[model samples]
Target: MSNKLFCEGRWTEAIAQYQKLLEIQLGDADIYYNLSYCYRQLNLLDEYFQALQQAIKLYPQEGKLHFSLIIDLRRNGRIQEAILNAENAAKCLPNDYTFKILKYLTVPSIYENQEEINFYRQRFIQGLQNLIQQTYLKTKEEQQSALAGIGRLTNFYLSYQAQNDIDLQRQYAKLVHEIMAANYPQWVVSLSMPKLQPNQKIRIGYASHYLHSYSGTLWLTGWLRYCDRQNFEIYCYYTGNEPDPVTQQFQNYSDIFHHIPYNLSAVCEQIIADKLHILVFPEIGMDAQTMQMAGLRLAPLQCVAWGHPVTTGLPTIDYFLSSELMEAENAQEHYSEKLIRLPNIGVSYPKPYIPPVVKTRSDFGLEDDAVIYLCCQAPSKYLPQYDFIFAEIACRLPEAKFVFLRGTLLEPRLKRAFAAVGLNSEDYCVLLNIPERLDYLMINLLSDVYLDTFTWSGGNTTLEAIACNLPIVTCPGEFMRGRHSDSFLKMLGVTDTIAENETEYIEIAVKLGLDLAWRRTIAERMSQNHDRLFDDKACVEGLESFYKEVCSKHFSA
Candidate 1:
């Protein structure tokens, strides 16, 4: 009965059946394993862990069970335990490439400090090397599994790299695309496009898994809302499961909105049926189905923008639409697609609706006089090497407090990162609860200075800071992802806070934190220049111009 229920995909019913079977025969490892699978499917994480633990205990040498437990542990935020189990799983299943790859995926979430990050990063590279070496021996089925795993999340690989190497990033992205292409070769071949009818509104489709209040939503909403409805008919193909007010708002602005079903083949067929002249995937690498579709000729012209800000590495993608200010002169060479540099800072953002600050500094237990430097980027954005900057800032300003928002799961790693530079987490940094959007904005408004992450810089947060008229001190790196704040600051005509080097980054952060007059003047200037950055209509106009150029080229071809 349990097996039947599991086979039918009724995971909740399967769990109940498994529990009944378990009550009858308590020591069955297979039952526990099946129970764990059911628990995992239902996302009852604690139950999943317990069942997996029991399964692992009963079947000590079972490599697959250990693998399942590793995932569960990580998912449940048992970071240290997850790492230990991953290592154990690798030892138990020395030849299994999945276990080895899983180790690299889990390691970055919980680094101790610079040394550990460096050590694991090297191990990850070595693991990739090993994965490539063993690929030749695998069966056709196993090879497909390995290829499917490769592009599951390329963001992990991009983030794991010690430094920003655009070449290597391109390589990683290209490899993933190749794997995906190999699996779906039909998608790689260009479809025959019909000539566009004169005077017909060009249908522009935006594809993404995040159509809610996510970064992709935030990045594209302004353009969607303000796009020239007369010339361009906008269609939003949202693939996310969660639908919120933001999703509804996007639907309201769009000529047509589709909640794309999960079936990949069906999704492709639906998109093709729409006969879209152009399709723009705001984010690709993050979603498997979206990335797969992106590898296809769903439209005459398919382009990608900087929702996640990494290369698609797919041949089918025509242009990588980017901001003129954000990208360097040689940025075109880094992308797989033809680079389209839009005038201004690229997309115009909607003006932020600043909610009343319902809560005070005392509510968050922040000291009244402390110079709070908020480093609120996700824990993954934090490279261990950047910990020194925080330490230096704390040292220079004794009354300083660094607030690292979220990543309670990454506490062990974060503590170690800070501890490496002789700064304790308690003394230097405060971990705050991930507040609601309005509260987060309020926190940004209240904070003294925003310290932008080096590698994967803040995108939406940078815009939010600018909206709140808060001062941000940024250190732009080699990649486009690191240059968001730099672009925004430059666009806002405020360059004093743009740090050229790590030394400058530290100097600027300290200067802003200490000098009240200088900081106030910059903040005031930011408020004055907010209109320059929040030109949503201008962004739409620029985007429409680009679209016209691309569509014209497509039609002429």
Candidate 2:
């Protein structure tokens, strides 16, 4: 009965039955895995972790369990724990070098310096090359499984190190493609696209694991919201996400909605059968399943967008759909795929609605009169090199208090970095609980200025702040990932906050902190012009044209 419930995707009901079964048969490792899988589907992270531990203890040699645990660790930014497990997995699965590569792929969340980051990156690159060069006697199926395990999350941490990762990213992509080719040679060479039948709309497939409500994925929906459904038949492959309202909206938009969470081969076969004209990965490197799928040629023409904002180095990806504003003139060099710069900010992102809330600064334990700079990017993005910005800003404005989302593991690192510069971080920095969606908007509403991270800029967070009429102070960095706010501000025609150098960034921030009139002026400008960002039909129209053009070119006579 538990198995039946599980088969039907009734995760909650199945979990209850599994628990009862487990109470009687604690020795069954497979049952423990099922319980853990059910808990994970429900997003009960701690419960899932515990159940996985029990399952692994019962059967330590199982490759799937180890990979599952490692994937979970990688997802939660538990770098040290993931590395430890990768090391263990490498020891256990000596024949499969994927875990050994995975150990290097996961870097330190908080780097001590450039040298430390370089060390990890070099090792990761070397590991990928080694995998490509070495021989494995493992069967094609086993090799395919290993590739999926490693591809669960690509080298996402490397982008935060503020360097061009094209070589390294492409190297990994080459390795992934090599394995994929070995397993499925037919997909290695692109299949000719089927001709479009009379009265038929283009069959477009969009695949990703983040089709639900998440901040990182918010921009992805903009394309779908305004799509020309009459001209395009959208087929969405949701690769395992807890269904939310956002997921429901995607279902409403899709002609065919498929939720294939496990069984990589089955998903690939299903995609092949769909015979899509164009396949789009809204974001890759975030989900293992999506990453694994991107390595294969299920579609004649495949593309990736800046939803995750890093170039997917896979040779199978035909294009990188980006924005004219976000990418530099030479941006083509950054990606393996052909660069297609869409108009404005590219995606027709709807202006977020931040309802009027009367939450005062004191409600969040913030001083009512202090200059609250929301430095709320994940703790990992706050590099040691940029930690001085907080201290420098605080020195000029004594009442300056930077608000950061609480991260227990890496929060102390930021605090220590502040101490090294002779600043008492507690006085200048407030590590607070990450609030609910509306409350996060309220935090933006309450804050004086939005402090953008130097290397990795905020995407949706910047948009939300703009929606709140908040003034953003950003210094555009070297890469496209670092220039998100630069694009937003340029599109909004508010370039006053964009800084060219560290000195100017601090100066601009200081001026914003001191001059209330100036802040009010910038807020007024945003209020007048911010509406331009939302509900764009032009980008959608452009997307439709792109679809028709690509299909026309690829379709067989």
Candidate 3:
């Protein structure tokens, strides 16, 4: 009966039936496993985990259960437990390549110091070497079979290590290509130039799971909106994300839209059938499925934008779409693909819509007189090496409280870092989750200044803060990924807050915290030049010209 309900998509009914079966102690491993799947479908993660534990106790040798547990544990910010679980799984299933790969790939979601970052990075490299050796030893059929599961985890956190990762990226990409090509030789085969009839439009493809209500979506929306629809046929292939209004908007924009499943072969064949003249992935390296897709040579010209802002390292990827303002002169050295620097910020962004209702600091349990230093980013972006910058700013001003999201993995790491420096982070930190979209904007509006993360700068968050007229203090890094806000500020003609180094970053942050007039002056300047930042006509023109030129050149060659 439970199995019937499970197959019929009745998760809640399935859960009740499974619990009833277990009430009289008549359950087996299959019952417990089924219950766990039902609980997971309903988002009862704790319940799902307990059911998995029960199943594991009944059948200790179940490699699939071990794999699921490790994945969920890592997803829920239980990294320490996940690491232990992976190690245990590997010990039990010694011959299982999945467990071995998971064991080596598991790293902390948040780090303690630079030494910790270096340690895991080196371990990752060693693990890659081991994986390469294992792959080389496998038969082509074995390698092809391994391809389905190997992409479950990517080197996602490696990009946040504040270092150039071109070499590591290339190594991983090559391994992926070898596996993929063996499994599906048709996709890896190179295609000739697209010979489109003059009357027919150039079919351009855009694929990503984050095409709905994500920061990645926000970054690439303007490019779609400003596309020359008359000459270009946009094909949007969305994978796995639930359809929201943003998803619908993309569907509306595309000449052909495929809200496809995550099935690898099906997606690959559909894209090949479309015969895209050019394929533009707004971001890569963030999504496992997208990374796998980017490994195949499906389009005549393949390009990736800086949605994730790191080198893909895949030879299958031909170009990295970036910005002239964001990239340094030597930026070409950081990417495996040929870097195509687009004009302005590389995106003609649609400015964020300001919500009407504003909430006060007191309403949100924040002090009215305090200088709210907004550092709202994904917790991983705040590296421990830079925690002292906050401590220095707090010492300069007693009423300074840095704002971050609640229920983050970095909370304890941040608290310990401040405690090491003889300061209690709780006193100077406002860790609250503002869940509503309007409330999110309200928090940004009530803040005094925006503190941009040094190495992994904010793209949509900075743009939203600028919508609130917030003064941003940013220090650009050596790579293009760390220089987003620096470019935005420069485009808006606000230069004082663009710091050159760590010391200058602190100095600028302190000045913003200390003087109300200075903050207002900066905000006023941003407000005056706000129009220059949006509806970037030249960026669209440049992008379109690049498309035409590339198509012509590839055809001639």
Candidate 4:
């Protein structure tokens, strides 16, 4: 009864049934697991943890109980406990298929910290080497199993190296493609969605995991608010566990708002049942839940936007929301999705909190005479080319220091990349435990110039830097990450700072460092031009007009 109730989406009743079962049998592990599932469904964090702990304690030898606990711990950002539980679970069911899956899920956290990443990378490499040695001694079936395990381990290690090493990403992508073709061929083709009527009101669906506090959601909120109500209906599909105050505000703008937790198939079916004409995937590869949803064709027109600038490489994704500034002459040829350009500076919305001015360099731990060069790019954006460029700038400016905000997963690799480029540890700093987004913005104000990363540009970071009256020097590259800074700089009327190549990039950095007057002039203008770059009203008008044009074409066809 509890399982049936849970499947039927009656989670509260499911919890009641589980509670009754637990009362009759105090040591029922399955009942405790069901209760934990129900609590997780209702976003009752404490109850979920308590129930999961009870389930694990009752069924200490069960792999599934430990797996569930590991998942919950990781989701709640309890990394240390998750790692320990994963290790224990691996020991409990050494040869089980579920154990392999649980181990895969837990391995990423081993690379969450700097020291852990290096340690795991070496451990994985050594394990693969040992497996190769054992293959010669084993039977054919055993050898094949060992090779498969090694393949999976290689993919995990490659994903960790992808940020700082492009060669590794390419090599891993090839290996994964080969392995999938040989092992799981069914995952290749794109899933098709329901057909749509031309005259019907276009039902646009927005999908995201961070529909709560993320900056990408801020842009999406404005787009939904300004949608043409007469011609279109907006549907929001959120995969997040908890809904914040902003998420509640976003709910008010949607025709239908549904939180389908962890059920990708049901979420896709729900959107298809509603006859959604357009499905917008705001986050591409960031969240597993969001990525799984994008793999299914939930609507007739599946689109991706600002959240992830990379090509999703999924055939189900039909279009990429882009702009002239970001999508260069050859972008359409490179990316898998059809390009749809927005009229203005791509997709951006105004942030609710504005940062206050910092009085001095002492505020953020910097010398008054130091020329602070800030790169607030997320750790994944720190490519080899970016390291080379920054090294050149540091070499040219002896008094300059580089500062970065470390991501939860990539801090160690980031520090290593900086060191590899001849930058001293003292010349770099990483700020931790920042309580709010506004605090991050205030720190940007203390910098002299904000340098944009290559390959992948800073999106929200660039906008926030401008908002804090910091001048940004960007050299636009090929894809989404490369072009974001270009679009924002153009929108803010500060295109002179954009460079073309290595020489120009270094020159631009030096100029920004040496010419204080020019830097101040650009910063002052950028501060005044925030209205044009982040105005919600203008963004809405442009989006609504584009929607009308697309609707007209669809109807006429």
Candidate 5:
């Protein structure tokens, strides 16, 4: 009965049954696991943690219990505890991929300190080499498990490296992909045309984990509202818990709004049942659940756009939504997805909430005279090139300081990265983790100049800064993160601010820093241009045309 309730998605009922079983002294590891699973399903974090802890305590030797607890702890921000549990779990199940993955998470990084970070980095490399050696020495099943374990470790390291180095991240990704393909040959595939009906209404399904309270939802709103209700139907598949006010208001516009939690196979099955002609993935590789769901070919035409600007590197994704400015013909071959160029910029937007500049230099521990070269992009977006460029800018402008808005969780790492660049911890750097969106806007307004990141461009951040009347100096690269600022800058008529290389990037930053009148003029012009770039009516028109063309092509074919 508990299993039935769980299967039917009545997680509360399932928990009640599990609790009853526990009270009768029929409690077992499986019952405890079920109770924990039910709590996770309900997103009751505390309850899930408690139940998982009890399960692990009751069955200390149970490898799966330890592994589950490790995941729970990591998700709940108890990384140090997760490391300890993972170590215990690994001792019990030496070959378990889950435990191995968790163990990698515990490995300290170079950001911890030069000595410790370097030690762990070398250890990680040695551990990976040993795992590969063991895979070659073990049975076929063991090799597969070992390869998967190595892949997880590769991903964890890649996450940390990606913040500072793009090339290293790419190299790591390539190595992991090759290893996985060698073990699981059927997992990766070269791009191929998708099989589909020649004539049908193009069914465009937008999939996102943040179909609530995020830029993805905001950009998609006008498009959904103006979709031709008769010829083309929009299906929104959401994987998040908090349904924002916009989400509630926009549901009436979509043909269907799926609020189910992320179950990749289940989501795929639902998409197949709906027989979507064109599946649009709005959120890129940010959510593992969405990525897993996307790997399944539920729709004939699967396209990716927005949310994450980077190429997903997944073979299942068919097309990438881009504009002529972002993707030239030469650049298309580099990406994993086929390039589909929209007539205008691929994304549309609504006017942003431009909060007044209320933050003073005193709030961030800075002087009013300091020329602030602020990077409003999250610490994760701070690539090594960005660090070099910003540091160079600071070096050139003695009076300029770098202010970074680090996430609460990323403050320590951000500080370490800055310190590595020879900047004093408090002399030139200030870290503010603002929880309120309005406060964030106010903070952006405080900066004299905004510096953009490469690999993953500042989408919302760039827009918000422009809305706050700040001059943003950017350089468009070959990929999504590289080109985002270019697209926005072009739309806003700020082409003069786009730089070509490191020299040019620094030159532009220095020029902006020195010329206060020019900065004020550009900021004023950008503020006026923000309306044109983020105009809801213009965006809706472009979206309607794109939808009609997609439907026409599908129907005609």
Candidate 6:
């Protein structure tokens, strides 16, 4: 009966039926699991936890249930417990590689025991090497059969590690290509087409899942809006079918806009049917389907911009379009794609919409006189080592309160991280989930200084901070992913807050927090220099020139 309700998509009715079944006979573990699913779908986390716990208790040997609980624990910021659960699952199913991969992926998030983490890291590397060896030694057919799961695990490993090392990043990316070559060896597609007229518009297509008010959407919207429409015919292929005002605006600018509701193959077919001379992905690696499609040869010239800001590691990707200012001196050595640097901050950015500051410091429980330093990047962007930087800043500015946007599931981990560095929870605060964009902007406006994350720096958030005229203090790291705000600040002509190293990062943040006059000077400069960074027309022209060069080279070949 509960199954009937569940199949009919009646989650509340299914919960009721499950409750009735539990009242009559409570020993059935499957019933409890079903109830947990219903509660999870309904967003009743407490009830979901209770039901899942009961299910696990009733069926301790069920690996699938254990895995589900492990995911739940990890999602709720219980990383250590999640690792332990994965250990138990691995013990229960020794042959399964999933649990081992889970344990490996959770290692970076664990900051308490460095020695234990080192041990697990070594074990994971050794296990991965062994898997790669075994998989490579297999026949083509066997490798294809095993590549699906192995490919996914390798991608996860690369995603986490890309924030850390470039050499290891290259290795993991090569492993992905190896898997793809084994599975889909015929990636290149041959095209027989007519030559373009003397002044035909270059057909270009931009594809992604984020076509709304998101990181990629915001970064590429200006390009779509201000591109040389006469010389470049643009097509937008959005996988996310949901349409908002931004989506409608993109449609208004694009010559052809497609909201792809079909599968990956169908989406690929649509692109091929368009016969685009060039295809661009604003970002890759955030979605599995996008990554898979990216691994295929889709167009004559394929390039990726700093949307996700990492090496794609696919041979089909021809160019890594990066900013001239943000990348390090040795940036090209890190990317698998051929590096192409664009002047200024690369793509044209949408003009920031500064909503009215509706809330006050007092309304948010912040003291009127205290210096507030805001670090609103998502939690996963934070590396465990950067806790010391925050601690040092808090220590230097005793009256300063560090603020972070909440709901990133890093509250407990952050508390532990700060405690390890001798800073108490009282030294910082996490602002609760702000649902409205205006409220988020208000928080940025209310804050004194913006602190960027160390490795995976904030992209859209950095622009929003600039929009609010908030002075950002950034410690640019070794990779392009960590340099978005660095580039933005440079483009804004405010390099005083861009720190050179970790020590300088702490000193700069502390100086900005304690020194009122200097901080205000930087803020005023940022406000005055917004035009340098917000010049969408110039950026679009640069992009148009690059597209024309790529098209000319392709057709000439």
Best-performing candidate as measured by lDDT: 3
- Candidate 2 residue lDDT tens string, 1-557: 99999999999999989988877866477787888899998889899888877787778778778888887876666667887888788787776656756655667666766677778777766666775566352687567655655655566677777788888888877777777777767777777887778888888899887888876677777788778867888998887759898899888878899988766777788888999889999888777668778889999889998888888899999999888888888888888889988888888787887799778889899988999998778766777677677788887899898888755545566577678777787888787776577678778899999989888898888888999999999988877888899999988888999999999999999999999999999999989997677666777777778878887776634
Error of 4 at 296 (Å): 2.4
* Deviation (Å) of 335 in candidate 6: 0.6
Clashes of each: 0, 1, 0, 1, 3, 0
Quantify all predictions' global Cα lDDT against the true fold: 0.76, 0.81, 0.84, 0.66, 0.67, 0.74
Candidate 2 contains a number of clashing pairs equal to 1
Q: Give the top-scoring candidate (TM-score).
A: 3
Clashing pairs in 2: 152-288
* Selected candidate, larger lDDT, 5 vs 6: 6
- List where candidate 3 sits over 4 angstroms from the true fold: 1-23, 26-51, 61-64, 75-80, 91-97, 136-144
Q: What TM-score does model 3 achieve against the real structure?
A: 0.91
> Candidate 3: deviation at residue 456, Å?
0.6
Cα-based TM-score, every candidate: 0.83, 0.86, 0.91, 0.67, 0.70, 0.84
lDDT for each residue of candidate 5 in 1-557, tens digit (9 for 90 to 100): 88889889899989988788788895778888888888988879789889988887778777667867876675554657777888788777776765765664355322333454455556556655554344442467765665545423334323333323333333434444454455545434432323344454446788777877787557777677666666677888877777878778557778788877645445656766777777788865566556555555566667787566555565567677766557655766556677766645666666777755677877867788999877776554554334456556766787887777764444554455557777654566666767788767767777799988765678877877777878888877656556777888887887889988868988999999999999988988997777667744654555557656665665566
lDDT of 6 by residue, 1-557 (tens): 99899888899999998888878876467777778889998879888877877777678766567767777776665767777887777676555545655655444433333354456566656655655554441476555544443433334323433344445445554665565566656655544332588877889899987788787667788888777777889999988767788888778889999888536667888888898888899887776567766777777778888887888777778898888887888888888888888888887787687977778988778888888888787655765666667667766777877777752555565577668767785656555667677777888999999988886787889988998889888877778888889999888888999888889888888888878899999989888888888845776777788888877766777
Candidate 5 Cα errors over 4 Å, as ranges: 1-91, 94-96, 100-201, 263-266, 363-365, 385-388, 407-425, 536-557
Q: Which scores greater on lDDT, model 1 or model 6? A: 1
Ranking by lDDT: 3, 2, 1, 6, 5, 4
Residue pairs with colliding backbones in model 4 are 457-481
lDDT of candidate 1 at residue 243, scale 0 to 100 = 90
Predicted candidate 3 versus true structure: per-residue lDDT over 1-557, tens digit per residue? 88899899899998898888789786877787788988898889999888887788778788778888988887666877887888888787666667767787676666777898889888888987887776642575576446755656577877888888999899988987877787777889899877878798888999897888888766676788888988899999998667888888788878899988677777788888999999989988788888889989999889999888999999899999999999999999999999999999989888778876557888889988999999888877888888888888887778899998643666777687678778898889888888788888999899998999989898999998998899999989899979999999999999899999999998998899898999999999998988899778778878888888899898778
TM-score of 4: 0.67
